[model samples]
Target: MSFQPLIHMFSITVESNTPLTPLDNVNDIAIEFLTHIGYLSKGYTPRSDAEDTSNSIPYVLFMDCFMKHPHKAWTADELAYELKTTKATVYRHINKLKSLDLLEEASAEQSDGKIKKGYKIRFGDLRKAWSFVEANVQMAMQNYRKTVEHFCDLMANDNTD
Candidate 1:
């Protein structure tokens, strides 16, 4: 994996003067990066005739919840309660993050001592989880390169035959 993510992170800011740290600017930074990676849209407004909630709200809220409570494993129910959203909404966002390989399943101890299945940022570290994703992407690219090279070699040999 390259250091581009680190570089990308360093390059992000909440605004011209707001320092990006202490969870204050992290959500905006996360949103920016998510947009840059195609996981989110920059901004949108539904037509006046339509009644669609901005999908970006759930994504931003879910990410901000994590940034605020970084180590807290969360069930969809908990997220729904905290975000004042629905379980289905929470799960939709959770699934999206999961698809990015950013979240990991875990067991959280409930108030009554029952262990509930939940999720958290992988290893409780966003940067570390991002590195894991970058590694997977790098490996996949290498495999694709090998396949293309082999395909080209086969085509060259077939032409001679």
Candidate 2:
């Protein structure tokens, strides 16, 4: 099997903005936060053309299933059933979160006593999960910094006159 990076791919947008005060509604905050982090498309247009993203499968899977029950490990099948979508759709969303290092793999015992792979919010807390993401960003930056320094050294040592 090819060695897959722990994070297959990671992308985030950083922008300066005034800190937001907590909204009276959590879903409102969740939508804004998810969009800012690039997990949800900023220009999301659902198939039904519904104005509310809260009803979208990806949003519901993240907000309703994962955020609402942070401590519970969710299997893709369970999420697909809950969201009434296919397992592929559920995995697509889950993989996005995984790329962000915001989820932790877990084992859940099925009703038949078989253990299945599951995923949950890292450390069962969003704040803790974000810290993990931050660490990853820092490490990636450090690697880039090293490469830049090495390239500079190579250029400086070139003796061609």
Q: Which stretches of candidate 2 lie over 4 Å from their true place?
A: 1-8, 48-51, 155-161
Tens digit of lDDT per residue, candidate 1, span 1-161?
Answer: 66453221111112233433545665566655665554554564422232432334455455667656668888777888876767887786677677667778888889999999888888889889888777766766797699899999989889564
Best by lDDT: 2
TM-score for each model: 0.68, 0.83
Q: Tens-digit lDDT track for model 2 on 1-161?
A: 89675644766665565555657778888888788878888888665444678898878888888889999989989998998878998898898998888888998789999999999999999999999889878888898899899999999998987
Model 1 score (lDDT)? 0.66
Clashes in each model (backbone N, CA, C under 3 Å)?
0, 0
Worst 10 residues of 2 by lDDT: 13-22
